[model samples]
Target: MKPVSELLKKRAAAVRSVAPESTVFDALHLLAEYDVGALVVMQDGKLQGIFSERDYTRKIALQGRDSRHTTVREVMTPSVLVVRPDSDVRECMSLMSQRKIRHLPVVDGDRVTGMISIRDLMDDIIADDEMTIAQLQSYIYG
Candidate 1:
């Protein structure tokens, strides 16, 4: 697997983020618009936290809080686990698996660079596996 930076490079879209002060409704809107499960919470261009569908489900919907009146900072996962640009795909997988999280923010210091999801890792892994299989088949057949 390649470094996180490489994956970031291959990603065609910019990192989707929302402000911590934004309403949960606003965050949810962005999530839906982008078709992503999670978003990096940025405050003044710095990584502040992360808001995910799980956060909305667990903190807002379960608690009966109205998203329009609730702020993302109030319910976001503030003590965020992040990966560096140089981090290995396996390292990210380990952290995500152990934490039972689907998303991880890629940061350089406090600056949010990108976000990675479980689907991204799975796609990369599957591509790598397919390439390896193709190589083995060519070697055997030739």
Candidate 2:
């Protein structure tokens, strides 16, 4: 099984983040601009939590809270599920499925490295399957 570090190398290494004290509205704008479903909540160069569109909808809009006044920390998921660089991709998939979460932060020690989504894993799996099928076809025809 491939490790998350390999997957991280295949894509951009930058992990977008916002300060915990930032307003939900600001975080929303960052999400829109990045076209991502979630953003890592950072405070003092540390991973504080995770803020996603779901948090905004469920915690802010549903609660009738003002996005401009509400802090990202207030609506963010405080207890985030994180993965390590050496973690297997399959394990990450299982965790996401069991937890019903869409995103995970890749951490190496205390530093946040990258972020991966369900879509990323699914795409990688599909690609690997395709490669295997192609190799099988080549061997059969040889």
Candidate 3:
């Protein structure tokens, strides 16, 4: 039952972000450049919202809005779901599943420390399962 802090330690510390006032096209560019599906929308060094590919497709493209002219704040998910460093990984996974969300910002106090995706949680779970199986095998053989 590893906490999310352990997972964050294993990942790159840099959290890719964009300003709320930034154009959707610019945010999309950042997303492509970072090779990520989402970007944290920040304002005054605080978490404002989250901009994701799903937001782009449903809010911008589907609405026939111009990405070059539309602001990220206009399409970003403003009501973000956040977690803390000490939060359990399993709990985060359950929240993501129930909410049908892919990304969650890891906030400690007022600062955003990192972001975790469903993929990250799933990978950790798989690794944990493998380790448990190996330990069981070793104990049985010994």
Candidate 4:
């Protein structure tokens, strides 16, 4: 399995983020703009929490809280499960599966590098398998 650092390199150049004090409405807009399911909640270059669609739906929509007024800090998922850049991709997948979560923030010491979804891991695994199959076919037939 590749390290999380390799996956990070393949990700977008910017890691979209918002401050804890940002309104849920604004966070939602950022999510839409970035075409992502979640945004990292950061303040002073540190990861505070993660604000996601799940957080919005369960905490604001279901709870009848106004997104325009309510702060992301009110609904954001805290104590986020983070993985170091050197962490194995498969291990991160297992962690997300067992925890029933979709996103994992890649951290190196005190800095947040990037985030990865289960979809990213699955795509990487599938690509690796396809390459192996191609190599096997070449050896067998050529």
Candidate 5:
């Protein structure tokens, strides 16, 4: 089975992120621009928090807070669950499943390495299974 590092290596080299001081509104804009569900919050090249659509909905919208006035530090998940670049894909999947989170920030120490979504995992798993089935069929038929 391929590792999470392999998936990250196969995809783009880095994660999408914003500064912790950035407003929730700005973070929302960045998420829309990147077409992603979450953005890793970084400050001084160190991971700070993670902001997601759920945060905006649950924290800002539910509280009737002004997104433009609130910073990511105010609305983001401060205790973010992060995965290492060397972690296995199964480990990542388990984390996401157990936490009920769709997005996970991949970190290499203090640096943001990449971001992953549940969709990415499902796609990779499906592709791998298909490849395995095809290989088995070819061997049996040949």
Candidate 6:
């Protein structure tokens, strides 16, 4: 099984984040520019919450709130589900599934190290499975 720490290390460890006081419009801009679905909300270098496209759609758009004027703290998901860098990808997947969350922030001690998305986990799993199958085939033939 691939550990989240390995996956994060192989991929970029950079995680996009915004201040809690930042406007939702700013978060949206970051999300679009980074081609990411979510942003970690930080306050003084501490993880505050998470803001995602889902929050915008369900909390802002549904309520007809102005993204430009509203702060991310107003619409962000404040529960802030997090996982350790050494955690297994399967555990992360299960936590996300149970919470119905798409993104999880990875922490190393008290510091935010990286972030993982459901799509990222899925892609890794698919690639790993393919590699395993290929190795098995080679073993049988050789």
Tell me the tens digit of each residue's lDDT in model 5 across 67-137: 99999998899998988878778778888999899988887877778998999988888898899999999
lDDT, model 2, position 130: 100
State every prediction's TM-score relative to the real structure: 0.95, 0.97, 0.97, 0.96, 0.93, 0.95
lDDT of 6 by residue, 19-101 (tens): 88999998999999999999999888899999999999999999999999999998898989899988899888889999999
Between prediction 5 and prediction 6, which has the larger TM-score? Answer: 6
Whole-model lDDT for model 3 versus the true structure? 0.96
lDDT of 1 by residue, 8-53 (tens): 8898658899999999999999999999999998887888889999
Q: Which number leads on lDDT?
A: 3
Q: Estimate the TM-score for candidate 3.
A: 0.97
lDDT of candidate 3 at residue 69, scale 0 to 100: 98
In model 4, the clashing pairs are none
Kindly give the stretch of ten consecutive residues in candidate 5 with the minimal lDDT sum: 1-10
Candidate 3: where is the Cα deviation over 4 Å? none
lDDT (Cα, 0-100) at 73 in candidate 1: 97
Report the lDDT tens digits of candidate 3 across residue range 1-142.
Answer: 7889999999899989999999999999999999999999999999999999999999999999999999999999999999999999999999999999999999999999999999999999999999999999999998
Q: How many backbone clashes does candidate 1 have?
A: 0
What lDDT tens digits, residue by residue, belong to model 4 across residues 1-142? 6998998898786888999999999999999999889889999999999999999999999999999999999999988999999999899989999999999998889988899988999999889899999999999999
Q: Select the stronger candidate by TM-score from 3 and 6.
A: 3
Considering TM-score, which of the candidate structures 4 and 6 is the better prediction for this target? 4
Clashes of 3: 0
lDDT of 1 at 120: 91
lDDT of each: 0.91, 0.95, 0.96, 0.92, 0.88, 0.90
lDDT of 4 at 62: 96
